[model samples]
Target: MADETPPVDEMLYEQLAQDALRGVIRSALERAALPAGIPGAHHFYVTFKTRAPGVSVPPDIMAKYPDEMTVVLQHQYWDLTVEATRFSVMLKFGGMPKVLSMPYTAVTRFYDPSVQFLLQFEAPATIEEIAVEIAAMPPAEVEPLGGDDAPKVVSLDQFRKK
Candidate 1:
């Protein structure tokens, strides 16, 4: 007897899964946005495509991390606003504060070290549909990070396929 299984239709399950996972990231950030702040020791390390559409970072910093950058949200991050398609936050690098705005489609990895949870997704082939306006925010003082607590930004190339 022949197998009765039918070929899967082009339902775009992969894109669906990616969207759902990004939703998780959004939800977590939403919780972190509460007045109490990222409850307890919980924090996030978000890795995203620096050159991806709708991503806005300082010019020099963009030149430094032209490919991808990982930011730690443990402390000294402010004005975290989570929107339907993207999120923006202010983080300090070298004692200079900068606001980064990126669409969820630009995020390649989201990890919570405290819980050892991880989510990796393929960035969209094209992000022309994601229109985001980069708003300038007044520079605010952010506490300097200590040596041990500073963001450990390493190349995420190893995690990517050649």
Candidate 2:
């Protein structure tokens, strides 16, 4: 028999690293959830998979944003609660209020324009399970957070290995 090297799976290492990075998001959100709120020019723009396993949102919003959605935690958000595996917050959309619950595993990006900090994650396989043409959807516009400066939006695609 021809000698062939068995394929080594690196999934465990990748999972561990992703979990550790998610902890960073959790820690920052926990700090922001404090009475003082996000301090000293810090804010977050979180992008998550709308249909992820543990995600919950209003049916209409889910329908409007079938594949993915981004949320801002700058000034108008309320009831920000962070837990070990997930977070829930109240936000307004078109003069209507909505609560969103998201697990860390659902998050694909976390960014803070104030410090130009950004983190991007690999989209969970479930994203592929849904057959929506995500790229065809129009981008959601978010109001600027007290500045004329626009945050750089990084596409996770650049980091993916072909």
TM-score of each: 0.72, 0.74
RMSD of each: 18.1, 16.5
lDDT of 2 at 116: 97
lDDT of 1 at 26: 97
Candidate 1 per-residue lDDT over residues 64-149, each given as its tens digit: 99888999998789999999999999999899889999999889999999989999977643332232211232344454677455
Worst 10 residues of 1 by lDDT: 128-137
Best by TM-score: 2
Give the Cα lDDT of each candidate: 0.81, 0.86
RMSD of 1: 18.1
Model 1 misplacement above 4 A: 1-8, 126-162
